[model samples]
Target chain A: MMEKVAQMIAVTGAQAVAHAMRQIEPDVVAAYPITPQTPIVEYFAKFVADGVVKTEMIPVESEHSAMSAVVGAAAAGARAMTATSANGLALMHEIVYIAASTRLPVVMPVVNRALSGPINIHCDHSDTMAERDSGWIQFYVEDAQEAYDLTILSVRLAEHEHVRLPVMVNQDGFIISHGVEPVSFLPDDVVKKFVGELKPIYPLLDTEHPVTYGPLDLYDYYFEHKRQQIEAMKNVEKVFPEVAQEFFKISGRKYSFVEPYKLDDAEHVMVALGSTNGTVKYTVDKMREEGCKVGLLKIWMFRPFPKDEIQRYLTGRKSVVVLDRSASFGAEAPLYEAVKSSLYESASRPLLSSFIYGLGGRGIAIEDVEEAFEKSISGELVTDYEYYLGLRE
Target chain B: MAEQKGWKDIPIGGTIVEAGSAREYKTGDWRVLRPVYDRSKCIDCMMCWFYCPDLAIIQEDAVMKGIDYYYCKGCGICASVCPKSAIEMKPETDFAEEG
Candidate 1:
């Protein structure tokens, strides 16, 4: 496959995602608008109206209906996609599990934002983190470029033969979704060939070969069916990097389940996900100049939790701190629990601690990360399970 | 009859093998009372056939034939919908003597 020279263009994460959707030109897009993610579907809707793509753009009444429509279309053997944010994603909660359990590979882009109570619209991982166990293959992107690339790759990964499960590409709400950055766009023909044609395993619409979905399963088979989903997610961990390698050939960029930065020979490490990695990189570099052995581990895919890769990176480190953007209330935050469990049996495990930061889009400065790393390395700090990094008093 | 499958052998996404497969699983065991039809008084109005929750009423070419007891949960919908009072609900134990 002869590749076209990728063109660099300035666009926000949402716009870049829409451009990828336009290029892929799926058969159906059923989505409702929400903060930060609204522009993604809005731009794709424009592409549909302008006849640039032949996708059937459904302006659904709600996020629940949007996911329901996508599930129906995908089961009928059509390539389908959607987009949503915090509250909208919460509304689609029930059907999200249906999409996974039914094994429909519907691709969606989720703009990460704080879940509402006092109603603040800003960047946080609360929404996607809350849905960790819903059984979807999840990917968190650091910036607009990664957001665009991963959005295109998710379609292929979701439709892969081994992993016929729904996929969500996540980017932080305003930090990445609304921020404009220079993104390298692949040619339409290249993306078309890369995604190829979706081959649905058992299409309900094929009258000649009919199949039923979402049937009642009592104790006789419910557990067995859930085991199938577990097997599918296991396939995701093996299949993700392979798809990324194929993507790396077309474009010059490579991606993995996790990205480790300056971990070698570092005594202290901070693990986080999404757009925070961009800031963490600068903080790590500055701390390195001062002779502090500090590093950062940026997690790209969260759902299958990538335990093996995490152990490989943090093996020799002295102290590790996990930064979570969402609170788990009565328990330690989600990422902290995952990291702790992964290292629980390792021979040379680091002293682990959890720090909850950026709730409701609270600012996390480099000093906060540096302070956490400093306290973690000092050995005088009490082994408190979890700390709120930037909370006032 | 549809070939029976173990829980593991069933299709991945709860797909039933054939259309209208409720016949394969005899649900009559769930019944405490069974519907008895007095066919001589039956008008063949087909109301019971249409309103049966179990679709247990056997009809051929719009003519009421009989009830398929295999799937009839004895819900008594046929007795309730029969305008002629031709269908009656009887205790399931009473049918043991006839069997």
Candidate 2:
């Protein structure tokens, strides 16, 4: 007799994300449903009603209140989860930063979508980019498989004592969130074992010993508290890989916070994050076949800014191109600039390039990256903070 | 103002510290100005005490006081009912230093 396993289940990426949440068996989930992010919360709420998953699902009145509730719940030592999209995440901005710095280890699944200017809702990086400074460790997933895998690893990573920051797992709205695909879900026992038993944190609403978590820090204590957040982030660069190794050992699907594809002796490489890296990697493999030296560096973890991994990957490269789906307004895209600074200390140099592509849900193709490589080599390289690629010329 | 008599002296809650800390407290976040008074206001004919929503205004030994801060948002109902000009709306920001 063989045990039935969900080796490959055909489900929407939203379902995969939601199922993963149940597998983590969070203690509390408070979320207000918005378009492109509604189904996930709905599915989880149903999970609660059916007793399929033992969790408290609080349907909130508004996104802002949902965030506030999660912060308070998490501070009270609950394993909390929430899902939201563009404007929803925008509504959660203030608390999002607090959630991270408070080190409550709240995990959120962000369905990446475009911010409304003229009003459009599809796949884009605008939402998560708006939260780039929110101190949450962001993992951009291109497909349902990665979504399921990333969601599980998030709990493992965030709960690390040294890396107690909230994490955001980003999946492109409508693309990955709505797109149905066969995903591989780890068994409940397997996931439970991997996630381990959640330990109750002290002073977490323990009236026996009242303790403050998110206090209004005076100017004198504010910087020190902020340093504490940064110091925890610094530990993640060391702890993430170790945790990931344990994940891979059990699940057999491995991911580094930073993945460099075909960079092994390449003269130039394109560095980008999120689901878009799939296209870049395919293009890099094709270019390699033609004896071209172009490669791809895919960023799996955007928050901790894997400087050491980046420095190691870009060491011997001649040129590097970074593509961002969101614009930074006054400066270059956050990831592009972070990579440049990380490489600055490296003696093995590469002429770094920057491109702000796919803003406002615009489509990007393999040709866009191929074109970027051409312009970079011909010295038509972008001299500005960022260049708009695949946008109306 | 005589229609509104004794305002404070309302046993908002049996609290010693917060009740006496300030005789009057005002919170108008509810889109209406409300005033609460200290316990020294007398002539409690139960006018202001009867006009309250939760009946939060009460008379203690012939003196009227409002609800304590714990349960009292300082809606000023007690002050509104006081015909004696004993109740005045005090802003919550007055105690911002305490926060």
**Candidate 1 segments exceeding 4 Å error:** A1-4, B1-8, B33-69, B76-99
Task: Give the alpha carbon lDDT tens digit for every residue of A356-382 in model 1.
Answer: 899988888988888888897787445
Taking all chains together, the TM-score of candidate 2 against the true structure is 0.77
Highest lDDT against the true fold, candidate: 1
Candidate 2 lDDT: 0.77
Q: Ten consecutive residues with minimal summed lDDT in candidate 1 chain A?
A: A1-10
Q: What DockQ results for candidate 1?
A: 0.37
Q: Model 2 chain A — which ten-residue stretch has the worst lDDT?
A: A212-221
> What is the C-alpha DockQ of each candidate?
0.37, 0.03
Q: Residues A1-393, candidate 2, lDDT per residue (tens digit)?
A: 112364778888899988898888898999999879888998888889989888988888988888889888887878888999998889888888778767778889999888877677877788888888777888888688888898999998888877778899998887788888988777887888899866645435566655555544443345656667777778888888898899898789888878777777778888887778878888788777877888888888888788888999998777788888887777778778888889888988777778888766677888987888887667777543467788776
Query: Model 2 has how many clashing residue pairs?
Result: 12
Candidate 1 pairs with clashing backbones = none
What's model 2's lDDT at A86? 92
